[model samples]
Target: MLVSFRLPLLNEEMDINDAAGIQALLEQLRSSQAWQEAVALPTAPNEPNIVPEPEESNSAPSASVAELLSQLRTEPDTSTLDRPSEPTPSLPKPTTPATPHLTPLTPTAPTADLSDLSRHLTFQQALPVIANLSGNPNLIQTLKSVRVLLTCLLELMFPSQMKDEQHALETRLMEERKAIVTKYEEKVKVAKTKASMIGSGMSKHEASMLSGAFHKELKSFDTERVLTAWDGLVSQQQDALSQLGIPIMFASTEPSHRESQQKVIQVLEGLL
Candidate 1:
């Protein structure tokens, strides 16, 4: 097929009849200054070269090729394909307030008194008081009786300082002592009234029987009965005091126990 072209500048007609002629025409046009100027005509700053297809070809670049060229011109950002894209910005999550931890406190036990305990007046110092109160000149027996009295009184008054069983025992013994004293007092009153009736003309046989009954009652309700009960109570109390770790046997023992005992004694003394 023969392709004809009229050159505007040279005012000549050329025909490309074969491949050789087309090659020769391309070489001639590349060397010409006029062709060079037309080829160098700038279309856009950054764009692909778009040369028109030959008029002899029935297919004008396919739809795919045109679409591809359009995409290349529109979307020029292709450098990001090799490198990774920037991460999208994310919103920070809402923060929650922290709860505070609380600690519990322990309660302290009550402390004993000090100023009143400084007087140093306890059952140990009760020798003179005992001698005067009982009118007993025998020092040895009096001191022994004082200790027994002190032990019984200390446990009875300060049951809080003793063990549960010891405290219960002391409570029972004290209640028993109270009952004995009450019974003794009632018996004494009745005996005194009966003695008053002896001289009021009662029969001799009845008088003799009353006298024998009074003697028997007197023997039964004597100081020995109360003393026997107190002795037993003191023995138990001494054991209880030893179990409690209180060194009350001697005046020269642990001063802390003595001080605590003295504190309680001072309060009792004040009450007395």
Candidate 2:
């Protein structure tokens, strides 16, 4: 840069041949630099010039977030400005109806005759009666067995025609059975007594008599006779039941009804 000034000075200020002129040019350059050090200079043309903004002004500056919030709090809302206010809809109230008076109904009795003899009875109808008569589920099975034997007997003999003869025969048989049992007990006791007496030194005749009487009494209570009598009475009752068309439940001879019959028999036994 000093060379640029030196070239112009060489061309116009002084003669390069004179040494006195060269010394004078250097002295002028130093003086100019010294004067510049004593005085302030403006910014260079290449640099930006900045000036401080004034703190106080008439026009408002852009607001900070805090200032904007406070301004909003102090100001009235403009969002709903010029808009009309609407009325809320009124809802209708519900109305309840008055309660009505009700009449109580009475139960009516059945019109059918329950005891009509001509009514055809099924097992369902008869079972209850049978259960009632038997009074025990076990007895139902025994009654069924007796009925079965009686039915077989009825196939070979004539049935009774007397009114309620079946019930009468049953009652008579039960009484006879009781009597037989009592008589058997008495016979057993007498036989035991007579044998005991014979060992206590009875005469030959008395001994023979006691032995003969004991054997005779023992033979008198014939099991087969008792059974035959019972069978006869049952046959007559069976005839009566057949005459009435009463069904014997679980009495089917078919193997298909076997399980049902067993179940019915069991149930009857329980009822009895």
Candidate 3:
């Protein structure tokens, strides 16, 4: 800071050459209560306007606050309607978190009789495992990223040997899925029992309120969980479709016939 506090015949004098000078000036300012009080005083009416000097403020849009408000009112916000009232229940602990970088898309867990490993071949069983894996994600991914993951998934699932291996992969995935479900069931049971424990201690009014709240929350929780599961399944199907070009008009087996079919089938089979 450069300052000439003294009102002279012509000009006053003060300038800080470096940080040390600035620090010393600050210390002096802090120590002098009168200086502090003077600094705190409101600016003189005769002083120039202190509007912030935004480098490009003049070049930008200068909509008045009222106009900006009117513009805001013109656009409808759909995000509010799309938000869920409550989140899904916490499921069991997963072994490894899914990644946006999963080189080949695959379900982490199978959806079929995963418990019956013997019912299907190992390769066939892997599809669901890959799908389940694909579903798990950190806080970073969006719906679009999930879609991109499907491309890698398509390539992995639609291999030439898919039919031979699909069932086995499916079986393995089902087994892992059963384990996850069992773990989550146990957690839900614990939460339920804990929830019940709070019931016996309340007055009638409290009981009624708590009961209603829990009922509502539980319903929401269940719906959220079910929807999440359904979404994961649907995502798998969507990924399959994205790879196969819809109806898979490219099959060699018939006019069944013209292109991305085999890859699409491989992708869906892996999800099973």
The estimated TM-scores of all candidates read 0.24, 0.22, 0.18
Candidate 3 whole-model C-alpha lDDT, 0 to 1: 0.40
Which of the two, 1 or 3, has more TM-score?
1
lDDT of each: 0.45, 0.44, 0.40
Model 2 RMSD in angstroms: 24.7
List model 3 lDDT by residue over 40-154, tens digit each. 4455589754432222223111122122223223233357667766877889887786666748767666656433332232434545544554554421122222322222133
Pick the winner on lDDT between candidates 1 and 2: 1
Please name the candidate that would achieve the greatest TM-score relative to the true structure: 1
- Give the root-mean-square deviation of each candidate in angstroms: 18.6, 24.7, 44.4
User: 29, model 2: CA deviation in Å?
Assistant: 99
Poorly placed runs, candidate 3 (over 4 Å): 1-202, 245-272
> Model 2: clashing residue pairs?
135-272, 136-272, 137-268, 137-269, 137-270, 137-271, 137-272, 138-269
lDDT of each residue in 184-253, candidate 1, tens digit only: 5665667567767875444577656666766555556444564455555555554443343333322222
* CA shift of 265, model 2, Å: 7.5
TM-score of 1: 0.24
